[model samples]
Each structure stands twice: as C-alpha cells, then as structure tokens.
Target: MKFLFLICAAQGRPTATPVDNGTVVGTLGPVDDDVEVWVKEYDEGSAEDSGRRLAGDRLTGHTETVRVRGGEVLVTDGPFLESKEYIAGFDLIEAPSLDVAREIASKHPMAHYTGIEIRPLPE
Candidate 1:
C-alpha cells in the first residue's frame, strides 16, 4: 500500500523547527540530519524525489478563491477556511501494511514536533 504523509505545524514554514512550548517537553528526535537521511533513502532508486515541500512559506496571510457558478466564473480574495495549522509538505511511500506506513511516518523528523496525517490512496 502507498500512503501520503501530510506534515503539519501550528506556525510558519514547514521547514521551521518549532520552539519548545511552555508545556513540559520530552526527548526530542534528531532534526535536520535525519530529514536528510530520510530523503536520501526514499529518493535513491526513484526517478524523482518521493516528497517535496509546499509553498506555505509564501502565504503572506492572504488567499484567493476561484469558483464557477451559474455558468460564470468568480474570483475572490480571502481565506477559504480558518485553520491554525497548515500542511507543510507531503511524502509518498510504499509499505506492506498500515502499521509499517505509520512507522515510516513516525520517523519523519517533524513528526516529533508536528503532526503527520497518514492517508491511503483510494485508487
């Protein structure tokens, strides 16, 4: 099975290593180095990298909406939805089972600091 890892954080760019919150913190996972290793492991045999960062770094706190209604097109400038979190990027991987996939996701460096949502492809 193949899964998509949606990396999320409560603040800015997906690349930022989050600061420790005031709450008690536990052991931290390896950061940038592990990310480099993870990327190399996934990209070694592929034609292109298995993952890529998103453009949330350029959000500028504004968004544009597009829609077609009543046979006409409409455009608006504003946030479509309210969200305290943003998807920083995605990683696509193949695993034998959901458990294996979850394990892979948990290894992502940001998984310790942020959230990773695992989703299987329907098709």
Candidate 2:
C-alpha cells in the first residue's frame, strides 16, 4: 500500500529551519529498504505563482481558491482553512500496510514540530 503524508505547519516553508537532513535520513534508514519515499516542499512564490506551478506538477504549495457563482468568480489567497496551519510539504511513501505507513510517518523529523496526516492510496 502507498500512503500520502501531508505535512502541515504554521504557514511557512517546511525547510525554513536549518534541519539536518542527514539525521532524518539516518533515522528512517531502517525502513528505507522496505518503503519508497518521495519528499517535496512547496515552492517559494506568490500564491498565484504557486497555484500556476502546481497545476503542472504533482505537488502543491501555497494555495488559492476560485469559486464561480452567478457568473462571478471569487478568488481568495492562502489555504482554505481560517487557522494558521498550512500544508508545507508532503511525503508519498509506499509501505506494506497502513500500520507500517503510520509508523514511518511518525518517525519523520517534522512530526515532532508539525502535523502529518496519512491517507492511503487506492491499490
């Protein structure tokens, strides 16, 4: 099974801090052979630019909302939520099961400071 982990933080880039990637890689090495992981961060750009960039890629960074109502298009910047939390990055990981995926997500270095939401992909 494959799981997508949405990494959320308080409205900033995931790599904004000087995190030691080596440490994280070492921590996850045990599961590395069993799972395939792809990590991506949101691009540093204006909301409109980010949205446009995301349209051509598999990952989305900062977001914009467009709603059509009564022939009018309403546009809004930032995430859909009213809270400060925003999705900063994501990890697409292939694991043996949901339990294993959750375990792997929990081991992510960002999990200590931010939130990781795990969702299973269709087999």
Candidate 3:
C-alpha cells in the first residue's frame, strides 16, 4: 500500500529551527528505503510574491483563484482557505499496510512540532 504524509504547521508560525539532519534521518528505521520525502519552505511576503515564486519569476505576492458560477467566472486571490494551518511539505511512502504507514508517519522528525496527516492512495 502507498500513503501520503502531509506535513503542516500553523499559518503565522515561523519555520521550526533547524535540527541536525542526521538526527532527523535516524528516526526512520528501515522504512527509509520505502519513502520519498520533500520539504518546502514556508511562504513569506505577499501572496503575489508566492505566486511569482511558484511561477519561477520575480513578482509581488498573491495566488489567483478562479471560480465559475451561473456561467460567470470569478477570480480571487490569496490562499484557498482562511485557516490557522498550512502544509509545509509531504512524504510519499510505500508500506505493507496502514499500520506500517502510520508508524512511519509518527517517526517523522516534523511530527514533534507540526501536524502529520496520513492518507492512503487509491489503486
């Protein structure tokens, strides 16, 4: 089975202080062979700046959102939701079962200060 671990943190909270990579890496046990991890830095400045960064260009901040209602298109800016949390990164992992996936997620270094959501992928 495969699962995705969504790493999240509070919206306004600055990124956690850096920890020794070796210390973080040591927690995975043998499951390291079955997982691929990606880390993302928290977005700073304006939303337009984030959009520009996402586009690999130089600009201000703002993320565009488009919606269709009554055959009319609506465009908006900023995040998709107004919440206290944002996703910081993710891990895609293969495990023998959900139990194994949960165990793997619980061992992630970020699990100590951030939220980790484990979700199964469909076949």
- Which predicted model would earn the best lDDT? 1
- CA-only RMSD, every prediction: 7.3, 12.0, 13.1
TM-score of 3: 0.53
What are the clashing pairs of model 2?
none
Q: What's the TM-score of each model vs. the native?
A: 0.61, 0.55, 0.53
Q: For model 1, how big is the CA root-mean-square deviation?
A: 7.3
Over the stretch 57-89, how does candidate 3's per-residue lDDT look in tens digits?
112335678999999999987767677765655
- How many clashing residue pairs, candidate 2? 0
Task: Report the alpha-carbon TM-score of model 1 versus the true structure.
Answer: 0.61
Residue lDDT tens for model 1, 8-121: 655543344435332221223345466667666655533333333221121245557789999899999865547867665677776666777777677666676677888886
Better of 2 and 3 by lDDT: 2
User: Model 1, 71: alpha-carbon shift in Å?
Assistant: 1.8
Clash count (model 1, backbone only):
0
On a 0 to 100 scale, what is the lDDT of residue 40 in model 3?
26
Q: Indicate whether candidate 2 or candidate 3 has the larger TM-score.
A: 2
lDDT of 1 at 102: 77
